[model samples]
Target: MAQLALDDYPDRYHLSNELHARPFPELTAPCRAAHLAIKQPRDAADRDRGRDFAHLVALLDRHGAPRPAPGANHYSGPLGRGFLKWEMHTEFVTYTIFADGVSQRPFSGEVFSLFPADWLAEAPGLVVTSCLVRVEVAGPDLEDRLGREVLSWFVPESLAVSQVVDAEAVVAADFRIDENGHCRVAVFARPGIGARRLGRIVQRMLEIETYKSMALLTLPTSRGVAQAVARLDGELSGVVAAMAEGGGQENKTLDQLLRMSAEIAQLSTASAFRFGAAGAYEAIVTQRIEVLREERIGGRQLLGEFMTRRFDPAMRTCRSARERLEELSSRAERAANLLRTRVDVENQAQNTEVLRQMSARAAMQLRLQETVEGLSVVAIGYYAVSLGTYLLGPVVEPVGIDKAHLSGLLVLPTLLGVWLMVRRVRARLDHGATH
Candidate 1:
């Protein structure tokens, strides 16, 4: 059989590989996992990503493990007896360690000691969140009461306990930072629960903690943005009200409006990525809890209920702040447009008045010019008549006619001819100007 000749796209393999990357760790029960997420405080998404890769490589070297490919965003392999999973995200990077046995102290923060102190001091960024997950398989002692021992491990006030995956496991977490500065989550699974299902549950628990922490990072930003939005809103309202008066100084008012609009746009652009990223993380948090199909344990609250009471408001604040910024930006844009139109109309009115005044001045000047032309014709005609009478006095005497009467007859004819000639010249000049 002959295969058809075809050309592959430049990124076909890379794109296909992306779909299968970052697979969940396969783990059996009675295990311990330590998860760490690190992010830069400023411009994290634009920071030098090579430093992150270098840090991962350094860790692999310390453990005598193979390194991930250059430019790869994820890696999973053995780090001594424990396994390591590393992933890079848009603004942060995460590392998770899975070991075979649970700690005797049950999340006493020993897992974190796996990373050398000097190596952690060289981390590329600050710790956004770190968690200790302890997975235990149900035994004769815990078969009927998986939550009994965990309930005592966490603080009772903020604790959340749930049965997930059709009651195959019981998960409990107070979602509180312990003295060791790590969030603690516990999972107690049934004996018959497959390794894959337990792995999935453990993955969900880590994601919820990490993403929840990431989502709340926007709350402080939202508070600052809220204040700015309020001030801009007030200023915009005043500018719009001033525009309604429709008077002079439109250009100055418009300048003020434009400045306000520019500020609004700036605020929107500055906070856009953070707010959007937080919103996405919040959705992931919700989805993870939903897929767990969480059911309450005894009179205790479910994970979903705990999130609703404590976490939902912070996320909503992020959303509300973003919404307000967008609304304020739109309002400023509308006001600027209206002010510009008003300025145009005002300028047009002023121009129309100027044109009207110019037209009136032109009409008055034309009348004055016509009066001066009539006076010039009279003066020229009088002079011409006087000269004719003086020169022809003797010639007319022989015919019995007086010089005074001759001058009288010449007066009207001279004036009429001069006026007609002046009219003809003025008509020619006016025709030239019209063209």
Candidate 2:
């Protein structure tokens, strides 16, 4: 087994290693962390990721830390007395720095100041969300003071407090941005909690904040989509009403309906990615909180309950907007198809009338042709008799007959011969035409 010789897929080892990547930091209590998620306002998903990587390197250079290999999407290393972790995501990048101890003024400017002002200003994109968090060692004597601190540091009305992970720690946050321009989160770990366990709790809190912010980004988009859907719905209904009324504007109504359908399709396409990303992020927020196994603290709201009252409605709105857009698209398509069928039937009736007129014209032309042929035979027979009188007069002079008598006698035979000649020509023409 030590040296088995077998072919392996090129990505096998790389994929296996990825599972161990982005490990939770081994953080003890009495730690301070600052996290930032940055994204380009426009086209973040298809951004030039190299710029994100370069920005990360600039910060790593400031700390004199070893750089990640080229094209790497994740890195963890030292920064001053803290550890700096960077991860690149599909639409954003995150930077989290964890230090050994809390600042004198915890959850304040001190933690966020870890990133130099100039460096932050030069970041590749705008900050989607940023936060400061403090993790402290729990003490039996400080329980009362800690409770008071939570009420004072966070907005009482929106605060979420819970004992999590079998009560190994307690977590609290108001989920609101403070004057310092960062959301604040606090954690207290009971005695004997391992570094890894403490790290996991802190990570979960930041994950919840990061993903929740991302998920809410879709709310405003959903509102805009809703408005568009409403306008399109009304216009489509008007077009449908026109179709029902039959104002001889089927072509016009059909054009309008098709345009509405195209607009709805465009709206759906534009909003698809944001809605999908929101749902995914929302699920992540829920899952991260679930793993903590939270129980309410001091009758304060748990994170799940808070989300149910606030966040869930926004997600539902987004879903409703998407569904309405789809429904409107279907309705427009159906209307357009119906109008087209009606127009086709009307056109088919018009074509039938035209064919009837053409058949009548052909019958009239055939009768006219027969009349002309009969007149032509009579004219030819009269000329043939005049010519025969001249020729037969010379022969009849010897039999006691003149030109006038010859003409009268030749008329019957001349007309009969002329009729035979006309019939023969008509037969040849008809046969040739059929072949």
Number of the top TM-score candidate: 1
* Candidate achieving the largest lDDT: 1
Worst 10 residues of 2 by lDDT: 105-114
Candidate 1 on 158-187: residue-level lDDT in tens? 988888999899898888988888999988
- Listed in order, each prediction's TM-score against the native is 0.92, 0.91
lDDT of 1 at 77: 93
List ranges where model 2 is wrong by over 4 Å.
2-6, 141-146, 384-435
Candidate 2 has which clashing residue pairs, if any? none
Residue 226, model 2: lDDT of 95
**Which pairs of residues clash in candidate 1, taking residues 3 or more apart in a chain or in different chains?**
none
| Tens digits of per-residue lDDT for model 2, 301-414 | 998998898888988998898888888888888988999999999999999999999999989998998899889888999999988987778888998988888888999998
